[model samples]
Target: MTGKTHIVGGIAASLAYAQIGNHDPLIMLGAGIIGALLPDICHGGSKIGRKLPLLSKLINMLFGHRTLTHSLLFLVIVAWLLNSFIPNEAVKAGILAGMVSHYLLDMATKNGIKLLFPIQMTVRFPLTTKTGSKVESIVFSLLTLVSFYYGFESLGYYL
Candidate 1:
C-alpha cells in the first residue's frame, strides 16, 4: 500500500484502539504508523527491506504480496516482538492495532490481502479503490482531519 493508505490505516487503527480502551494517543498513533508500513518491508528497497533482504524475500516468496505478512498471525508476532522492547501493555496494543489496520486497508484495495496467508484464502471487499487510487488521498485527508481533532482534543488540555 501507498503512504497515504498507510496513514489512513494508521489513523483508523489508532482510533479503533482509542475506542476500545483508555491509552495514550501518541503511542497508539505511533504503532499504527509502524504497522501500516511493516509489511512493505519486503519491497526489496525499503529501509527494512534492504536490511533484511533474505527474510523479506522469503516471506514474499512463500506468501506472495499482502498475504502472510498481512495476516492476524503476522500482527501477533509483531506485537510479541515489540512487547519485548516496550514491555508495556499499551504499547503492545498499539502495535497490533496498527498492523491490523494495515491489513484491513490492504483488503480494501483492488488486489486485496490474502488475510489467511498460508491457508490461501483471499479476503477482499466488494469495492476496491485500486492501488494508488484517489481514495488514498481522500482517505488520508480524512485521517489527518481526525488526527488533528483528536490529537489536540486529547493532548491539548494536558499540554
Candidate 2:
C-alpha cells in the first residue's frame, strides 16, 4: 500500500472510529492517518520501511507481511500503550485508527492480510486486488473525495 492508499484507508478507519468512539472528527482523522501507516513500520517497501529497512525487511522475512502487524494482539497492545501514556483520548483514538487502517488496506491486496495472525487465519475481501493496483488507485481516489467532502461538511458545521 502506498502513502495515498494509507492516507485514505486511515481516513476511513478514523471516520468509522470517530462514529463509533464519538470523538471529534479531526482528532479521529489524525488517529486514522496514524493507524493506516502504523503496520507498515515493519515493512521495507513501505514509506516508514525505508528508514528502518533492515528491521522492516527482517520482520517481513521472518513473519511475512500482514502476519504480525495485522493481528488483533498487536492492536490491543498498541491501544493499551496509547491509553496508558498518551494523555488524550484523541491521540489514542489515532493510534487505534492507524492500526485498523493498516490492516484493512492490506486486506484489499491480492495477498490479503492475516488479521488473525498466529492463529493461521487469512482475512481478505472476496475481491482480490494487486497491491498498488489500478483498483487501489480508485479506492484511494474515492477515499480522498469522501474525506474532502466530509472535511468541507465538518468545516461548515463547525464554522
Best-matching candidate per lDDT:
2
For model 2, the stretches where C-alpha displacement exceeds 4 angstroms are 19-22, 156-158
Tens-digit per-residue lDDT, 1-159, candidate 2: 677788887887676666557678888787778777778867777777887888898888888877887789789878888877888787788678777777777777778777777888888888878877788888888878877766655554356
TM per model?
Answer: 0.82, 0.85
lDDT of 1 by residue, 81-150 (tens): 8867877666677667777777777787888876776777788889778766788677777767876776
Q: What lDDT score goes with residue 23 in model 1?
A: 73
Candidate 2 at 52: error in angstroms? 3.2
